[model samples]
Target: MSNITNQSLSEILESINSKKISSLELTQAYIKNIENAKKLNAFVTTTFDQALENAKKFDNKPNNDQLLSGIPLAVKDLFCTENVKTTAGSNILNNFVPSYESTVTKNLWNNGAFLLGKLNCDEFAMGSSNETSFFGNVINPVGDHLVPGGSSGGSSSALAADLTPATIGTDTGGSIRQPASFTGTVGLKPTYGLCSRWGIVAFASSLDQAGPMTKTVNDCSIMLEAMSGFDEKDSTSINKKKESYSKNLKDNIKGLKIGIPKEYRVDNMPKEIDELWEKGKKILKDLGAQLIDISLPHTKYALPTYYIVAPAEASSNLARYDGVRYGYRSQKGKDLIEMYENTRSEGFGDEVKRRILIGTYVLSSGYYDAYYLKAQKVRQLIKKDFDDSFTKVDAILTPSTPSSAFKIGEKTNDPVSMYLNDIFTVPVNLAGLPALSLPAGLDKQGYPLGLQLIGKALDEQKILNIGYAFEKNCGYKNEIKKWWS
Candidate 1:
């Protein structure tokens, strides 16, 4: 039964559908694994009893028509789960459980998937490493001292550790892809408007999008089908018909053109990452994908532009947590104004406060045009760079990160160095396009390295298929041992 946990989500669903295993058995197996892997600190809240009850209910009334029938999935805490503690990895929302469900989770449940629990994340999804999480850092299952990639670290850690078959995570910048790269898994950031953001806690609203992180490319397509749809409540939602990404998946990218951006070869990048990118090009070439050397001149401006825009949005979105409504409050305040100041001062973590200050400064009347407004213009250029490249290619290829996962405390003191971790990933978010990261190889330290495929907006199916083709031919394997359990 414990071995059942090692199977991919698709295989688990097949076992359930074939009647070889019941939902209860699968749920129980995951519970045991979660119980044993406490040191990973991946889960912020465990709904084991609730999960078990849901599993029983699912087993008795199974529906084969549902995409994820009886599948128990864990999601990043950024989502507002009804009656479950929905902390956005910050003390401010530590006790704020939504009475109503988020539109994305509601869709999953409606399609027959139930919650396993809420996983941890960066405070307000701001940090590059899970260290910013108020609950504490989530250890990467790949190595004991390594930091799982941030924002969605807990989601990646759990999925890689097999605590959940597959999980959903929010990506603002590189949250989903970077961690997926570090942990030897598949993570996708869909086109910005493709998934609704109504129920998720706001990070950088315009940049934040929900995506699936899974063990396989196939599982990613299946999980994504269940999680994405148009919602009236979300102003940014795209009103396109739902896509059967899994059913239509094929690796027939024989003549598809993939762009290899010259600007992505950043200074001081690890040789292994460079090698992995080269290997990715060769693999695609062997699969008959035409590799075109392209240039994205605005790539150099992406990181700085992202830093300005994301924080500007963060400052505005996080102003609601002033202790006046819900969430943490400071009882020591003598007046209303003092209370408001005290609550925020006490509620947010250092990284959250840092971003809030940066956001506030950039959006201030005196500097708005100098910083925030200019960044928006640069963002347009970044999008245009992608659009220009897409005119000649179907997708773009790059290394997912500059290097493999680093130690937990290695770059915490230097914010600039920490920010560089997202250099390869931030541009995709800035452009509002879809991108997928898959493990391509391992570094000298035996840590996994990844390659990214960038697709045009609403072109998720093409990248997923390209990734699926790469996954089958690339020989990359998850060599991570279950050391925590």
Candidate 2:
């Protein structure tokens, strides 16, 4: 592997600014890395020509004031990149290219970051594993046959494999953080509405939020600062001034109150996961941060509530992908209705179809009150639970996942088993909070284990500070061999 692949995002930017490496040279090195890493299936579409062109353009300008000047990164295919194909990992929009770019991607570009390509994800961002992608499952860089958790699997895989310095991912129920945990990378799911959703393909509008995946918490803070702002185009976009999160990442945690929710203690969890949780608590306690035992009494119902609410929103949002306007259309359909039916049946993967069906069923007339309505109420209660808890604590600490990354095909046959992977993560989304996953240590199999730091809405800087303190003391190194190379 080239030495360039080992550099952090900030290091790369510094190298570019100091004339140690030209933008074109660095971009070409990453393009070469992506070319050699095809076996990982991390990229759905490679934009080498455009990336090189942009690199050359930035090289000509040489602006030191730009935030991410000459930086090479990848965006998850869920984000529209103006003329680049945004697949969302489903055949339904296999050839769909947007005339406009998502606000998040545009923000990165405006700050002088150029794209390497579009990363793969779950079909309509539906699956916990990247297996639901029409392209293929993204293989974890740590182990040959292990799965990189999804629907942002490709983003996480690319970051871990060093194909890109950093990448963007969307987290709807652990899509970003889970994959980051699996791959031993850092990922953040910013508070809902912190980053605008305009032009990104929506899975569940209420739950989906864009965040950065990188090698360190500092990179996450910088990227989150760059990507977040108010956008009048997106109704849910928060109308708050952009925060200098990177500047505020102090590693001071003394006297900060951290909450440990008792409901997170699920049964049959791996002993290693429990041990890691205890280890994380000790690390925080030793730093003089108070750890209080708290109860999120409604946590047990989070998964079920998410299933109903997310699918209902997904069913509504995805209804526009019929054979009429754009995307993949069916040639076998005889008439309009049949065209709609056949188009969806042929284009959607089984997991996406399943969610759409469940969504539709829950939103149906008679069952609406019983399922979707009830789930919405439960969702509010979940949010309220966090609201009540946050009054007593500054942040919450939990395990990112129930266990380490499983093999690619380990739980494919059991949908419920797959759903349980996001058990610890779902509640954060339910409450529209900011949460981050950082490498804590290696598991017994030498794969990475993650510790999650969740904060109240828009309190990303606090959790990031805590994560930085933990990272400094944890001594967790995310070094992997050039297996893909």
Writing each residue's lDDT as its tens digit, candidate 2 over 1-485 gives 24877888888878888988999999988888888999999999999999899889888988877779888888899999989898999899998988999999999988989889999999988988899999999999998898999999999999999899999999999999999999999999999999999998999999999999999888898899889999999999999878898888899899999999998888998889889999999999999999999999999899999999999999999999997888999998678999899999999999999999999999998999999999999999999999999999999999999999999999999999999999999999989999999999888899999989999999999999999899988989887887876
Steric collisions counted per model:
0, 0
- TM-score for every candidate vs. truth? 0.99, 0.99
Query: What are the per-model C-alpha RMSD values against the true structure?
Result: 0.8, 1.1
The C-alpha stretches of model 2 lying farther than 4 A from their native spots are none
Model 1 agreement with the true structure over 173-234: per-residue lDDT tens digits: 99999999999999999999988999899989989999999999999999899999999999
